[model samples]
Target: MSLVDLSWRNVRRNFRLYTIYFISMLVGVVIYFTFSSLMYNEDVVTAIQNKDNYGKIIFIASIIVFLFIVFFILYANSFFMKQRKKEFGMYLLYGMKERQVATMVFFETLFLSAISVSSGILIGGFLSKFFGMVLMNLMNYNDDISFAFPQEAIISTILLFTLLIGIITIQSYLNVRRVQLVELFHAKEKMDKPLKFSMPFAILSILLIVMSYYTITIAGDTNIWNDYFKEALIATTVSLIVGTYLFFRQFSGWVLQKMSQSKNYFKGNKMLWVSSLRFSIRGNTVNFTFNSLISAIVIFAVGFIAVDYAMKGEVVKKEFPNHFAFSTQDDETQKHIDKMMNESHPIIGHETITGIQTEKISNRKTFFSYPEYYTEEFYLFPESQLNAIVDLRGVGEKVDVEGVEAIVLTRGIDEPTKYESHQPEITVLDDNTFHVVEKIRYPLLSIPTNPGGDTGPQPSVLVISDEAFEHVKENRTLSSFEIYQIKDPKTSNDVSRKIYDIVMKTEGAYYSAYIDMYSIDTESSSLILFSVAFFAVIALFALGSVIYFKQLREATEEREHYAILRKIGVGDKEIKRIIRKQLLFVFLPPLILGLLHSWYLLYYTVILVIKDLPSLTTIIFSVMGLYVLTYLIFYVSSTSIYYKIINEKNRR
Candidate 1:
């Protein structure tokens, strides 16, 4: 038979062994194609308000996806080479030239790549509309998403994957060329040396990991954040990486060593898996460590992004209380804005917010116990006006400010004012003392607090009784703002753009429009969620597939050992039990460590950013549950395959 025919026959004969590889490659293709298609989808481009920014972000992300695909394919190629070394050796023994063997291996890769790429593109095309609808839904868009396979996306997927396939085929050819006859036939005989546990390394690994966690926790402290934030972040990252490596290399070995010395080491079926694990620990340490890090990253990324997407609306509302707000609005400008706004959207409610910007309040206290870095310009409002505004919005509770009493309102939960966490008696104008009676964590007005310079005032509000306000306003000029709540504010982009133009022309004028911010934020958030969710899924399944195949390789190598155990009267049930225990040890540690690591990361970072987010616990748990479920599926599938491989009856 021709070399091509032999290659095809070999693929068909070993189709079962190639199942995981085929599935993995197909998954990679689908992920890459789906993202590429979206990047060029005309409907998505037209719907997104900021196409340029989104284009840049998706392009960079696409590049990352491409690199990941290349890496995954190359890694799978290496695994395939190792698995088929004996087969290639037999072909050489039958007088097949080395060049012919290499050529045949290259043909095998080509066949698989052709099948995977075509199948992946077909599946991705069919699912593109569903994914598109998901993106639009996440962005709160109501437009219908029509299905069309963009030529750009298809071309990109084909070309990129072609390059990747070519690269892996070359790698396989090189691997075949370098393999010696003896090395090929005895490839499975090569074993990792037994690991020796060191007391110092084990303790050091624990200490390093603890130190890393501790640093991340304290990194949020005011003093630490100011002085050593960068250093702390670097230390935390490096220490965690080194610590995880040492943990698998040293700590795991020590535990297994202690287990082997225990009296229960010989307990029913424990000897079977334990002895096997101890024998393989040295080789498995690096794999476990790598997989553990990947797991942690996937969990942290998906968890945090999920929380961010879920809380987008709440966060936007908190940061921007009014649907339309602007400072320095005069009678004529208000008439013009009113006319423009009313033409597109009906105004639900409108309020003229009059307040005084004073630099007289003192004794500002913060939750972090540190002085703020901005000039404290208190935007003082009377309790009555504040109450009226809140009542109009129908959101926050009204506060009563008695004599010599004041209430502080901050921008939001995240942008805490200088005196946000504590209420202290403050002296206005250096003589009149006002006691802080209450504090509200809401941004009643969208003032340009610090406009990114060294001079502007920080956004802060102090609500005092009208009597106290009159006393303090002895010679101060009051600032007026126009706040409007509009109907269907999300659909008011055209009016917002016009109003924005008028506001920009007026000097010392600033406006915050709901549609302006909402469109950008929603689109950006949706893209982020889409991109990150894809990566999370691919990372989880791809790594899980790698682990699955790794175990299969181990099973194939140890098939003789299991047959010997069977000859010694070990029943099928007991062997299956042993297989379960062995696979459990292989799977659980990485997942548990990954969960722990991601929990700490989210608690320190995402929780702080979206503290008032609803159902945060549920979001985190749901992400982790999905991760565990994926691993569980892989674990079960691997166990079944491993048992089958080792228990198969010998055939001639």
Candidate 2:
């Protein structure tokens, strides 16, 4: 048979073993095609106001997907090449020329790549419809949805897979050329002792890790200056990655050595287990490190997406607590507005704070704040207050605002303590006299105050008195209005429409003041929730499948070792125990690190999304729960596959 036919038959016979790699490539293609389809969809094109920007988002997503595909293909292809070294050697020993052998290798890769890519694209085309439907549902795009195949996406997929396959073919050809026949034959037998690092390097790695953590913490808490803080975070992340890789490399050896010194070294299979694990880690340290980083990022991304979705619900509730909160510039629409409000919801006790705006042309400055802007002195408003605002128009008795020019603190304000200090500065305007008042703590009602810098509006200390309001409006006209909170939050939209109609009827005298009820749209929040859940499922599946398959490939090489141990009178139970231990060592560290990083990331991300982070207990428990469930599944699946391989080898 020709080399190409030989390679093809071998692939078919070993299809089960290669299925995982093929599936991964298929998934990458599917994701790429799905995203590309979304980007090129005519419906999406029409929906977005800024089509160019939408196109850019597509391009960016495509680029990210493409890079990931390249990395995954290259990594998996390396393993494939390693697995086939013996075959390559056999071909060379049969008197095949190196150039012919290289050509055969290239042809084999091209055949496999072509098959996988073509299947992926076809499957992806079908999946694109499903994905589009899901995305549309998540975004609340409910207007007459129909899936149409985008020619652009098809073309993009073809080009992308063509490039990927060409690269893999070249790499296979080069690898064949580089390896001598003897080297290829002995590739499976070439085992090197694990490298040991001095204590100083281990210490340095730990130090770097510590520094990275410290830097990230500082970055998280730094004042919201754009340039400096961004650079610091980027630097910290890079340092953390490098340090983490070095630590894994040296730490595995150090751990094995320490275990060897222990009494447990002679008990059971502790020594074997430790040695195997250390070898596995040392053998694939770079791969392990990169995998860890990828896992960490994936965890962080999933957590952020989840928390962001949850917070969107909270945002909507806070922004529109009651139905039809309205204000108007003119009194002519008052009766009509009241009628609309009454029709929309059962009116509870309605109250309005009226004030005239005058420009304080002398020395006063306008300042505002939200929960996020507060120092430790400003306690976030109690949930009860938010509930009351939503359900009952009664401001919870806990909030007390005093005189005109007094700070209308939304929540309680305490003096700054040692741990938390405030940067309270007063700026004098050229025309108006401004006074610093008690800071307010309200549920975030708008875009979160920029936490990274002091660029946006600070929390407001409401100067409640009409006199104080007037003092700040020198050149500005005094505009008077009322904010009415209604009994039913859901009816707020209907009431708003009624008020708009009234204001339209009143023409010149009544300008319908804009009250953003975007937050009241539960659909948006629901969509966000769906998107998070979908992506989380995808990420976990991808991570588990990739890791499981990679480990399975390696298991083939270790099958002989396990069989030899069995022949040497090691009990099957002991072998299994060793497998478990090795698996634990291989799997546990990345999870621990990823979870730790994810927890911290989620904590601050929550702070960014909502004014207050979730309770520490809640955050910790939720994260731990996710970790245990997913990790356990991964562990069980991986161990089962490993043991199965060993058992099969023993039988042979």
Candidate 3:
């Protein structure tokens, strides 16, 4: 009878149509609330050693999630408004004023937002603890996280959703006020405009995409990479973006146009779906392009996170082969460290190597310049002591230095010819010189002789024969280091912390404790992996919803056409087949393009850093398989709903 009653009744009648949209909004709210809660969560801040840094990361991720939720809500609202244009027209024909109809629309939005937001916040609060536990478990932490519902989080969620609700209501009101009865009734008949095809633009799109891939693949090998890497990267990204847009806008339409002209266009019901698909693609080109790009990003992100998390241990081990290492001048401090470490954890291997610190080194006529530490002052190690430590770690290449020849150990130099010129002659005390023979990138020590201890680039070490090492050690003031390999060093954070405190107290002391770097990296990487995974899920959810809602809207528009086909002797089976072909055309292209883009992108980027190609491939394909499975679920769901809508109209 009244506007409120009419709005409520319409909502109840159309509840089935709103189910997917409601669920999507509910999940978006839950994700937003859960992540926002973490920003101010006391449990997370207290559990993590660096509270400020953790808060900052969660804050930034929450903002991104919030923006995505806004986009999703607005998108779903547009679909709903389009679907109900006829209903609004009927209301206007029944003596309802435009302002009154707009009010009714506003009430409907308020009702849905109230139900979804309240229920979502309630569910999100309970689920926050589960996500917290997941984060802790991934980080290898054993701390128990208690239930916490931050008031700030609740207030923020309420305020943000309230603002979103206001925006949705305003949009609905404006749309209703501007609609005329004839336009509203005929809105669904306004089909997409035909595409203007051009062969040159289509070919250019393919060429641009190829050029972008070529640039990225050769980025590491070219002088352009060394001089203008940033510019090259920007150019590659721009080209890829433009190329993808053109592929969807021009190339896809051209192919459809060619298909229409071929004999295959009239093949049993092919025209039914093919013609529909052309129109759909023409209208949805921008949407399809965006979905393709987001899908690619999600695929690459998931693969990268999985690979990075898997290879973190190997990376940590390469950087920190020794369980504990420190350089100290005092013998008493070294003894105390050994005693303390031995008391806490059993030392599996230990070595006290003597090193000579000297600045007398010079080079001539080299194509590549070495690091300042390599050319200026550096540590000199005896071949025997280095071999002993190498045996202790059971890794790294041992050097064989003869006479005045020396070996250089460093990393990050890839070109072999850079070290072929006149080798550096290490001049020690009393004018002694050793010619450098071979260069290696193997990491053998933690400290880089810089102020950051083990944080800088791997420092170069000069390895010489025992006879030369002795001569230099006797003449120069020697630096002594105690290296230890302990059992289960990753689980020995407390012991590492105590030892770090002791080592820091000694003046001119440099140390590397495995647990410090390992735990921090583990925690940070796991958090990143979790955040990236959540983002991928959200993006996938958006992609699926976009297609699903779009299909439903089109189905509503084409119901009359299907009814006519049925009356003219078109069987349900043939119509269903047409539906299947039509929906597949919409669903399959972006997914295939996304898969190819991600595979190519990861091959050039993540695979270089993570060299275990086979394992990385397995992980990447596994993620893609899961993505495909999820997408198929949406496809099947959309097809079934579409058929049901058409069947009901045919029966009527």
**Cα RMSD, each candidate:** 5.4, 7.9, 3.9
Among these predicted structures, which one has the highest TM-score?
A: 3
As for lDDT, the candidate ahead, 2 or 3, is 3
Q: What is the alpha-carbon lDDT for the whole of candidate 2?
A: 0.58
- For 470-563, candidate 2 gives per-residue lDDT tens digits of 4454554433334455564442434555565554453333222112334223334433344444455455555555566567766777888888
Q: Candidate 3, after superposition: displacement of residue 30 in Å? A: 1.6
Instruction: Spell out the clash pairs found in candidate 1.
Output: none
lDDT rank, highest first? 1, 3, 2
Per-residue alpha-carbon lDDT of model 3 for 371-397, expressed as tens digits? 543434567888998889889989876
Candidate 2 wrong stretches, greater than 4 Å: 1-7, 40-54, 95-149, 197-243, 301-363, 366-550, 569-574, 600-633, 647-652
- What lDDT score goes with residue 561 in model 3? 88
Cα lDDT of candidate 1 equals: 0.79
lDDT of 1 by residue, 85-131 (tens): 99989998999988888888778877887898889888887677788
How accurate locally, in lDDT, is each candidate? 0.79, 0.58, 0.78
C-alpha RMSD of candidate 2: 7.9
Model 1 lDDT, residue 194, Cα: 80
